[model samples]
Target: MAPESTNPRGDLTSEVLHALSKSDPISSTEAFPGVPFESIKAALDRLASRSMVTYEQVEREEALLEPEAEIIVSHGSHEARVFEAVRQAIDGLSIQDLENKIGDKTVTKVGQGKAFKEKWIKKDGAKLVALVDSINDVTRDQLKVIQETRTHDAKILADLKKRKLLKMQKVISFRISKGPKFALEMVKEETDLTAEMLASGAWKTATFKPYNFKALGADQHAGALHPLNKVRQEFRQIFFEMGFEEMPTNQFVESGFWNFDALFVPQQHPARDLQDTFYVSDPVKAGRPAPASADDKHDYEAYFQNVREVHENGKYGSIGYRYPWSEDESLRLVLRTHTTSVSAAMLQKLAGQRKDGRVPPARYFSIDRVFRNETLDATHLCEFHQVEGVIADYGLTLGGLMEFMEIFFGAMGVTDLRFKPAYNPYTEPSMEIFSHHKGLNKLIEIGNSGIFRPEMLEVCLSDYQISSMKIETGGRR
Candidate 1:
């Protein structure tokens, strides 16, 4: 092995631009010897894009997940957290470093299983002495449950059974049946049927074709969707079955007017930042266009009125949001950070016609990709889909929200859940929903829900009445 270079360097592009200005089309070997040619080509293309060079970049390889990397970072694992923390702490430790530290070992063989077990016990005697006390009743009980759940290897099962906490009870039973009758045999020379002479006739030699009978393949597993995704599909189907029209799919690139400003999010809040959301290449945010002058005779004046009412306060005699409403800053564009964005859009679609008599009990659902600059981890992705739904009409309340959440989770095969107070700009008295997972022994925050605030209502509904009314303000209770 040779020692690698550790010299300080100038920008590759700056170097390339300087050389290209003076040299004829130089080959990658001339440009970056000892460096990968593909990297050299990329620098040239970037330079060319800015009119600094005349070369194109060819991609050498596509990025792929390493098998070992995938194993240590898959979701639903607390183990990954520890693994990552330990790996980060071990600075300057390489695979070769570990190998050198472990040194060489003598491989031994034993024919008998018991001999191998004895050897293992003897080798790890000190560790076993320290570990024996921690393997208490609860530990054994949990291990038994896990073994039963996994149905692992037979030897492992036997070891588990030997632990004394493991138990398998046998129940024996049998049923009697009618015994066989006369003996039967195959004979090549068949003769005289239904007569005593044919009962015991001489048989001729018989030969059969050679058959190479071998064991084939094993059983196949049925394909299935993930449980979370199945729940999302169910919600989607729920809305599709209802007559309420689905909202437009333009939210992934919606303006602040529809996402935050129209929905009454305080501009000073910390959520609207690159750290929390993805900003688009362009910043031309749009807002709910101001309604025509109060003196104008436009028929669409009623639409803006509904939006204003939703933001200013709750409709239908509900206590309106008391915050000073501003439409000027409501037009910034970014990723649809949450499915709550869909609810606002849905309300806009039903902006008018409350006078026509269609109001409360309006139902809508959306299961689509939403983006947020989340911390990527085993169970979390940079962006993921959410199942968003809302049922609106007069007399909708927080109890209804809780009831729907329970029913929805139950239908999705999640029987255990706990709720905590959460705040969302769109939903007043919002809640963060937590579900208990058996393995982890603690509640995991799964989703969020809340009753839309009056301002939210005004923004979404046409027949909204902006007045004080009874409502349980959302909070951690």
Candidate 2:
């Protein structure tokens, strides 16, 4: 016999070893009677950690009463109710009358069928007559017994299950046994080699805990860039390789003037609808762009007049949208819907340079986040990144745009390129770009490209040629 100990760990370890010495195996319930199984499991785990015992879990089926079955056990089965109803009647009631007395349709239907099958009742015309003097409900009695005992008789349990009166659940139980280092008693194991023990010459007799070299250690996580950032980096590198200057797109907040009006997009365009664009409203207003000096104010007024005329009266051998352009609407602030806003600003700066007689050929590119008010799905998001490129020189054409795209995508191992006819408000002769997807075995539309329309270009420059294209990407699909 093992000595009883007050320490729960030592006591549990000793009990398990003692039980295993007598019986080859013992269940957790059998070893720790009247104790919570979880507490016992915890004690067993501590012992197993010390390599003094071990356990194997087995799944067993347990029977439990369904809600309806419990009601039957409490109030008596439907057949029992029918039998009692018949006994209470001096002259047997008719089938319809008995149904009225019972009220429950299931009880009426099943009870009558079962009573007739057992010859406990017989039909006399429309009336039901009791043929037996007394009856017993074996189903109800068995269910009550099962509920009280929490044990099952195979045949009875199967019958109740077929009737949907009992449900079976899979429960886990532990079968524990002695480990390789089984012992009748447990001693506290030291986890460290203390200086006090060494100084007292007690290190030689200390029972140190064993080390488990095979045990897994905590995961070591290091910082890494997000998938979108990695792709953006690759795009940045490609832009650098192509001698394209990076445009500053740090301004996520922009006025509708630069976002749409300067781009020659109509005020009433569907893209400006609340359903498609996210409008900012905390301050509820954005300050107007102030001029640097009186001369700057005069220059901006002239530019503003030209943009307003282009939207209302058309310009440069083209018909404008011929609608009222609202200065208030243009002043409204929003989260930028595209990176092209930055390109628009850069174009304005280029226009000022042209005024100063210093127009220079330039290529600009930007990759930045944008927002929209749209329904989200696996293939769409409310916010995403936009990649844009602009070229300003003496003579850029639609053909030049196509060639530029070919070279740009070719650097990334994408050789197969297709351009489909498309439409945009600010870009004429627009085309949607596609690339062959090997894994998908089809051509997938990748982005959009086109030469900027004259109406959009006239607002930015007067004596220099310019072409711009934008692509929306970095959204989950």
Note the Cα lDDT for every prediction shown: 0.50, 0.78
After TM-score superposition, the amount by which residue 326's alpha carbon in candidate 2 deviates from its true location, in angstroms, is 0.6
lDDT of 1 by residue, 1-477 (tens): 112235534566556555544554553323444434445555555444334445432222112223322322332122222222223432323333323433321101111122223232122322111111111222224344444453444565566456442444332111111112111121222322434444554222322222325535577675687776675566666557544455556557876665665566756667777788777766666545544377543344465555556556645555655566665555667787766666765555555434456653566666677777888888667667666666766666677677767766676577677779887776678888888889899887777777766665654554554211111211111
Those runs of model 2 whose alpha carbons end farther than 4 Å from true positions after fitting are: 1-221, 291-298, 355-358, 464-477
lDDT per residue (tens digit) for residues 1-477 in model 2: 122334435365566677788886776434555445566677788888877788988777767899888988988888877877887887878777888899988888998888888888887777777888888888888888878765589988999999999988766668887888777777878899999999998889989988879878888785687887887888889889988999999989988888898889999999999999988887545655557476652366666777899999999777898998888898788999988878877876777665446466778888888999979987778888887777777667778778888888887677699999898877787889899999999998877877777788767776534445444334221
Candidate 1: 10-residue stretch with minimal lDDT: 468-477
What TM-score, to 2 decimals, does candidate 1 have? 0.44
Residue 42 shift from truth in candidate 1, angstroms = 60
